[model samples]
Target: MSPSVTDHVVGRALSWADIPRLVELEGRLFADDAWSAPTWWAELAARPRRDYVALESDGELVGYAGLDLAGEVADVMTIAVAPEAQGRGLGGELLALMASRAREAGAAYLLLEVRDDNAGAKALYARAGFEVVTVRRRYYQPGDVDALVMRLRLRDERDGVGDTNG
Candidate 1:
Protein backbone atom coordinates (compact mmCIF):
# COMPACT_ATOMS: atom_id res chain seq x y z
CA MET A 1 0.00 0.00 0.00
CA SER A 2 1.06 3.59 -0.53
CA PRO A 3 1.95 5.83 2.36
CA SER A 4 -0.67 8.22 3.66
CA VAL A 5 -0.36 11.97 4.24
CA THR A 6 0.91 11.38 7.79
CA ASP A 7 3.65 8.97 6.70
CA HIS A 8 6.40 11.59 7.04
CA VAL A 9 8.40 10.64 3.99
CA VAL A 10 11.47 12.80 3.60
CA GLY A 11 14.38 13.21 1.19
CA ARG A 12 17.94 14.12 2.18
CA ALA A 13 21.53 13.84 1.03
CA LEU A 14 22.95 10.34 1.18
CA SER A 15 25.94 9.79 3.45
CA TRP A 16 28.63 7.17 4.20
CA ALA A 17 26.76 6.16 7.33
CA ASP A 18 23.83 5.18 5.12
CA ILE A 19 25.92 2.84 2.97
CA PRO A 20 25.37 -0.26 5.06
CA ARG A 21 21.63 0.18 4.95
CA LEU A 22 21.85 0.98 1.24
CA VAL A 23 23.78 -2.24 0.71
CA GLU A 24 21.08 -4.17 2.48
CA LEU A 25 18.39 -2.57 0.39
CA GLU A 26 20.40 -3.18 -2.78
CA GLY A 27 20.57 -6.86 -2.03
CA ARG A 28 16.82 -7.06 -1.68
CA LEU A 29 16.13 -4.84 -4.66
CA PHE A 30 18.73 -5.99 -7.19
CA ALA A 31 19.66 -9.49 -6.05
CA ASP A 32 22.65 -10.78 -8.09
CA ASP A 33 23.09 -7.42 -9.78
CA ALA A 34 23.38 -5.51 -6.52
CA TRP A 35 26.51 -3.37 -6.02
CA SER A 36 28.98 -4.37 -3.29
CA ALA A 37 30.04 -2.28 -0.31
CA PRO A 38 33.42 -1.47 -1.86
CA THR A 39 31.77 -0.28 -5.06
CA TRP A 40 29.40 1.92 -3.08
CA TRP A 41 32.34 3.24 -1.11
CA ALA A 42 34.12 4.18 -4.29
CA GLU A 43 31.01 5.92 -5.54
CA LEU A 44 30.72 7.91 -2.33
CA ALA A 45 34.38 8.83 -2.54
CA ALA A 46 33.81 10.42 -5.94
CA ARG A 47 32.39 13.51 -4.17
CA PRO A 48 31.18 16.48 -6.25
CA ARG A 49 31.07 14.53 -9.48
CA ARG A 50 28.62 12.11 -7.98
CA ASP A 51 25.49 13.08 -6.09
CA TYR A 52 23.20 10.80 -4.10
CA VAL A 53 19.97 11.18 -2.21
CA ALA A 54 18.17 9.06 0.35
CA LEU A 55 14.49 8.83 1.18
CA GLU A 56 13.02 7.93 4.51
CA SER A 57 9.52 7.33 5.73
CA ASP A 58 8.89 7.71 9.42
CA GLY A 59 12.66 7.86 10.01
CA GLU A 60 13.48 4.60 8.18
CA LEU A 61 15.35 4.49 4.89
CA VAL A 62 13.05 3.48 2.07
CA GLY A 63 14.64 4.70 -1.17
CA TYR A 64 17.89 6.03 -2.65
CA ALA A 65 19.18 7.44 -5.93
CA GLY A 66 22.49 8.57 -7.34
CA LEU A 67 23.62 10.66 -10.29
CA ASP A 68 26.93 11.11 -12.04
CA LEU A 69 27.26 14.68 -13.23
CA ALA A 70 29.53 14.90 -16.25
CA GLY A 71 29.27 18.51 -17.42
CA GLU A 72 26.84 18.55 -20.38
CA VAL A 73 25.44 15.14 -19.62
CA ALA A 74 24.35 13.68 -16.29
CA ASP A 75 23.71 10.00 -15.88
CA VAL A 76 21.54 8.30 -13.34
CA MET A 77 23.75 5.83 -11.52
CA THR A 78 21.03 4.06 -9.59
CA ILE A 79 17.58 4.33 -8.10
CA ALA A 80 15.92 1.86 -5.79
CA VAL A 81 12.91 1.88 -3.54
CA ALA A 82 12.07 -0.81 -1.01
CA PRO A 83 9.54 -3.41 -2.15
CA GLU A 84 6.99 -2.16 0.33
CA ALA A 85 7.24 1.32 -1.14
CA GLN A 86 6.79 0.20 -4.73
CA GLY A 87 3.86 1.68 -6.70
CA ARG A 88 3.81 4.74 -4.52
CA GLY A 89 4.88 8.05 -6.15
CA LEU A 90 8.28 7.91 -4.41
CA GLY A 91 10.18 6.70 -7.44
CA GLY A 92 8.95 9.68 -9.43
CA GLU A 93 9.87 11.95 -6.57
CA LEU A 94 13.39 10.59 -6.46
CA LEU A 95 13.69 10.88 -10.22
CA ALA A 96 12.47 14.46 -10.16
CA LEU A 97 15.02 15.31 -7.53
CA MET A 98 17.84 13.84 -9.59
CA ALA A 99 16.71 15.72 -12.69
CA SER A 100 16.60 18.97 -10.76
CA ARG A 101 20.08 18.40 -9.42
CA ALA A 102 21.38 17.60 -12.88
CA ARG A 103 19.88 20.80 -14.24
CA GLU A 104 21.42 22.82 -11.44
CA ALA A 105 24.78 21.28 -12.29
CA GLY A 106 24.50 22.65 -15.84
CA ALA A 107 23.71 19.37 -17.50
CA ALA A 108 22.10 19.67 -20.93
CA TYR A 109 20.86 16.09 -20.88
CA LEU A 110 20.03 13.28 -18.48
CA LEU A 111 20.78 9.67 -19.38
CA LEU A 112 19.97 6.31 -17.84
CA GLU A 113 20.07 2.62 -18.66
CA VAL A 114 17.21 0.39 -17.67
CA ARG A 115 16.85 -3.32 -18.09
CA ASP A 116 14.34 -4.05 -20.84
CA ASP A 117 12.56 -6.56 -18.65
CA ASN A 118 11.70 -3.95 -16.05
CA ALA A 119 8.40 -2.69 -17.42
CA GLY A 120 7.62 -0.55 -14.41
CA ALA A 121 10.90 1.30 -14.58
CA LYS A 122 10.61 1.78 -18.32
CA ALA A 123 7.16 3.21 -17.83
CA LEU A 124 8.40 5.56 -15.15
CA TYR A 125 11.18 6.83 -17.38
CA ALA A 126 8.80 7.27 -20.24
CA ARG A 127 6.43 9.23 -18.06
CA ALA A 128 9.31 11.48 -17.09
CA GLY A 129 10.02 12.34 -20.79
CA PHE A 130 12.96 10.01 -21.34
CA GLU A 131 13.19 8.56 -24.81
CA VAL A 132 14.97 5.37 -25.69
CA VAL A 133 18.16 6.29 -27.47
CA THR A 134 19.29 2.75 -28.20
CA VAL A 135 19.29 -0.82 -26.97
CA ARG A 136 22.30 -2.83 -25.80
CA ARG A 137 21.80 -6.50 -26.44
CA ARG A 138 22.36 -8.78 -23.46
CA TYR A 139 23.98 -6.03 -21.45
CA TYR A 140 22.89 -7.51 -18.14
CA GLN A 141 24.73 -10.78 -17.47
CA PRO A 142 23.72 -14.04 -15.77
CA GLY A 143 20.14 -13.55 -16.92
CA ASP A 144 21.13 -11.89 -20.21
CA VAL A 145 18.64 -9.07 -20.11
CA ASP A 146 18.76 -6.27 -22.66
CA ALA A 147 19.49 -2.70 -21.59
CA LEU A 148 17.59 0.30 -22.90
CA VAL A 149 19.62 3.46 -23.06
CA MET A 150 17.34 6.41 -22.45
CA ARG A 151 17.94 10.14 -22.61
CA LEU A 152 16.07 13.22 -21.47
CA ARG A 153 16.72 16.65 -22.92
CA LEU A 154 17.38 18.88 -19.97
CA ARG A 155 18.37 21.72 -22.26
CA ASP A 156 14.81 22.04 -23.43
CA GLU A 157 13.70 22.80 -19.89
CA ARG A 158 15.92 25.85 -19.79
CA ASP A 159 14.08 27.16 -22.86
CA GLY A 160 10.73 26.04 -21.41
CA VAL A 161 10.43 23.27 -23.98
CA GLY A 162 10.22 20.27 -21.64
CA ASP A 163 9.77 19.29 -18.04
CA THR A 164 12.99 19.22 -16.08
CA ASN A 165 11.07 18.21 -13.01
CA GLY A 166 11.16 14.62 -14.29
Candidate 2:
Protein backbone atom coordinates (compact mmCIF):
# COMPACT_ATOMS: atom_id res chain seq x y z
CA MET A 1 0.00 0.00 0.00
CA SER A 2 1.06 3.56 -0.60
CA PRO A 3 1.96 5.82 2.31
CA SER A 4 -0.92 7.81 3.74
CA VAL A 5 -0.77 11.60 3.30
CA THR A 6 -0.75 12.15 7.08
CA ASP A 7 2.41 10.07 7.37
CA HIS A 8 4.56 12.78 5.83
CA VAL A 9 2.47 15.83 5.00
CA VAL A 10 1.30 18.82 6.99
CA GLY A 11 -2.18 20.18 6.42
CA ARG A 12 -3.36 23.72 7.02
CA ALA A 13 -5.81 26.35 5.84
CA LEU A 14 -5.30 27.46 2.26
CA SER A 15 -4.30 31.08 1.76
CA TRP A 16 -4.08 33.57 -1.10
CA ALA A 17 -0.50 32.50 -1.68
CA ASP A 18 -1.74 29.16 -3.03
CA ILE A 19 -3.74 30.53 -5.97
CA PRO A 20 -0.99 30.46 -8.58
CA ARG A 21 0.14 27.01 -7.68
CA LEU A 22 -3.45 25.82 -7.49
CA VAL A 23 -4.19 27.22 -10.93
CA GLU A 24 -1.16 25.45 -12.35
CA LEU A 25 -2.17 22.18 -10.80
CA GLU A 26 -5.72 22.61 -11.97
CA GLY A 27 -4.50 23.19 -15.50
CA ARG A 28 -2.47 20.02 -15.39
CA LEU A 29 -5.04 17.86 -13.62
CA PHE A 30 -8.30 19.04 -15.11
CA ALA A 31 -7.03 20.20 -18.46
CA ASP A 32 -9.95 21.69 -20.41
CA ASP A 33 -12.08 22.01 -17.30
CA ALA A 34 -9.55 23.65 -15.04
CA TRP A 35 -10.74 26.53 -12.92
CA SER A 36 -9.16 29.85 -13.79
CA ALA A 37 -7.21 32.11 -11.40
CA PRO A 38 -10.05 34.61 -11.26
CA THR A 39 -12.50 31.87 -10.34
CA TRP A 40 -10.21 30.86 -7.50
CA TRP A 41 -10.03 34.42 -6.32
CA ALA A 42 -13.80 34.66 -6.34
CA GLU A 43 -14.01 31.43 -4.39
CA LEU A 44 -11.65 32.78 -1.75
CA ALA A 45 -13.53 36.02 -1.57
CA ALA A 46 -16.64 34.12 -0.55
CA ARG A 47 -15.14 33.88 2.98
CA PRO A 48 -16.52 31.74 5.82
CA ARG A 49 -19.09 30.14 3.52
CA ARG A 50 -16.25 28.53 1.64
CA ASP A 51 -13.60 26.54 3.49
CA TYR A 52 -10.42 25.10 2.06
CA VAL A 53 -7.39 23.07 3.14
CA ALA A 54 -3.92 22.68 1.73
CA LEU A 55 -1.47 19.87 2.32
CA GLU A 56 2.28 20.23 2.07
CA SER A 57 5.13 17.80 2.10
CA ASP A 58 8.63 19.14 2.69
CA GLY A 59 7.20 22.63 2.36
CA GLU A 60 5.76 21.94 -1.08
CA LEU A 61 2.04 22.00 -1.69
CA VAL A 62 0.91 18.50 -2.71
CA GLY A 63 -2.87 18.66 -2.46
CA TYR A 64 -5.85 20.89 -1.70
CA ALA A 65 -9.63 20.69 -1.29
CA GLY A 66 -12.48 23.13 -0.81
CA LEU A 67 -16.03 23.01 0.50
CA ASP A 68 -19.02 25.34 0.29
CA LEU A 69 -21.21 25.18 3.34
CA ALA A 70 -24.84 26.14 2.74
CA GLY A 71 -27.26 25.35 5.48
CA GLU A 72 -28.00 21.59 5.61
CA VAL A 73 -25.91 20.88 2.54
CA ALA A 74 -22.27 21.34 1.69
CA ASP A 75 -20.85 21.11 -1.80
CA VAL A 76 -17.31 20.08 -2.56
CA MET A 77 -15.86 22.78 -4.77
CA THR A 78 -12.74 20.96 -5.82
CA ILE A 79 -10.03 18.51 -4.82
CA ALA A 80 -6.66 18.25 -6.46
CA VAL A 81 -3.43 16.38 -5.83
CA ALA A 82 -0.21 17.24 -7.61
CA PRO A 83 0.85 14.69 -10.21
CA GLU A 84 3.90 13.63 -8.25
CA ALA A 85 1.79 13.20 -5.11
CA GLN A 86 -0.88 11.00 -6.62
CA GLY A 87 -1.57 7.51 -5.22
CA ARG A 88 -0.39 8.44 -1.74
CA GLY A 89 -3.91 8.58 -0.32
CA LEU A 90 -3.79 12.37 -0.29
CA GLY A 91 -7.02 12.62 -2.29
CA GLY A 92 -8.90 10.49 0.18
CA GLU A 93 -7.50 12.43 3.09
CA LEU A 94 -8.50 15.70 1.48
CA LEU A 95 -11.96 14.36 0.76
CA ALA A 96 -12.35 13.21 4.36
CA LEU A 97 -11.31 16.64 5.54
CA MET A 98 -14.06 18.23 3.44
CA ALA A 99 -16.64 15.81 4.77
CA SER A 100 -15.60 16.36 8.36
CA ARG A 101 -15.70 20.11 7.92
CA ALA A 102 -19.17 19.93 6.41
CA ARG A 103 -20.47 17.76 9.21
CA GLU A 104 -18.95 20.04 11.80
CA ALA A 105 -20.87 22.89 10.20
CA GLY A 106 -24.09 20.91 10.76
CA ALA A 107 -24.56 19.90 7.15
CA ALA A 108 -26.81 16.91 6.64
CA TYR A 109 -25.56 16.09 3.14
CA LEU A 110 -22.42 16.52 1.09
CA LEU A 111 -22.49 16.71 -2.69
CA LEU A 112 -19.97 16.71 -5.51
CA GLU A 113 -19.85 16.13 -9.23
CA VAL A 114 -17.14 14.26 -11.11
CA ARG A 115 -16.70 13.69 -14.80
CA ASP A 116 -17.75 10.18 -15.67
CA ASP A 117 -14.56 9.66 -17.63
CA ASN A 118 -12.49 10.01 -14.47
CA ALA A 119 -12.58 6.41 -13.30
CA GLY A 120 -9.95 6.87 -10.62
CA ALA A 121 -11.75 9.81 -9.07
CA LYS A 122 -15.07 7.98 -9.23
CA ALA A 123 -13.46 5.03 -7.46
CA LEU A 124 -12.03 7.32 -4.84
CA TYR A 125 -15.40 8.92 -4.20
CA ALA A 126 -17.09 5.55 -4.04
CA ARG A 127 -14.51 4.30 -1.55
CA ALA A 128 -15.23 7.37 0.52
CA GLY A 129 -18.89 6.23 0.79
CA PHE A 130 -20.48 8.52 -1.77
CA GLU A 131 -23.33 7.24 -3.95
CA VAL A 132 -24.38 8.40 -7.36
CA VAL A 133 -27.48 10.52 -6.94
CA THR A 134 -27.84 11.54 -10.58
CA VAL A 135 -26.07 12.02 -13.87
CA ARG A 136 -25.93 15.22 -15.83
CA ARG A 137 -25.68 14.27 -19.46
CA ARG A 138 -22.94 16.09 -21.32
CA TYR A 139 -22.35 18.32 -18.37
CA TYR A 140 -18.73 18.86 -19.37
CA GLN A 141 -18.49 20.93 -22.51
CA PRO A 142 -16.09 20.74 -25.49
CA GLY A 143 -15.73 17.01 -25.04
CA ASP A 144 -19.36 16.56 -24.05
CA VAL A 145 -18.47 14.29 -21.16
CA ASP A 146 -21.09 13.31 -18.62
CA ALA A 147 -20.92 14.24 -14.98
CA LEU A 148 -21.98 12.05 -12.10
CA VAL A 149 -23.53 13.80 -9.16
CA MET A 150 -22.58 11.90 -6.04
CA ARG A 151 -23.82 12.44 -2.51
CA LEU A 152 -23.08 11.27 1.00
CA ARG A 153 -25.49 11.71 3.85
CA LEU A 154 -23.76 13.22 6.82
CA ARG A 155 -26.65 12.86 9.27
CA ASP A 156 -29.11 10.02 8.53
CA GLU A 157 -29.67 8.55 11.97
CA ARG A 158 -33.15 9.91 12.35
CA ASP A 159 -34.40 7.86 9.40
CA GLY A 160 -32.90 4.70 10.87
CA VAL A 161 -30.12 4.89 8.33
CA GLY A 162 -26.69 4.43 9.91
CA ASP A 163 -24.90 7.68 10.62
CA THR A 164 -21.58 8.27 8.87
CA ASN A 165 -19.94 9.74 11.97
CA GLY A 166 -17.19 7.17 11.67
- For each candidate, what TM-score against the reference? 0.92, 0.91
Q: What is the lDDT of candidate 2?
A: 0.86
Assess each prediction's global lDDT (C-alpha) against the native: 0.87, 0.86
In model 1, how large is the Cα lDDT of residue 21?
A: 94
C-alpha lDDT of residue 63 in model 2? 86
lDDT score at residue 51, model 1, on the 0-100 scale: 94
lDDT digits (tens) for residues 59-126 of candidate 2: 88888989999988899999988998899777888888888888888888999999999999999999
The candidate scoring highest on lDDT is: 1
Candidate achieving the largest TM-score:
1
Off by over 4 Å in 1: 1-5, 157-162
Residue 117, model 1: lDDT of 94
Distance from true position, residue 110, model 1, in Å?
Answer: 0.3
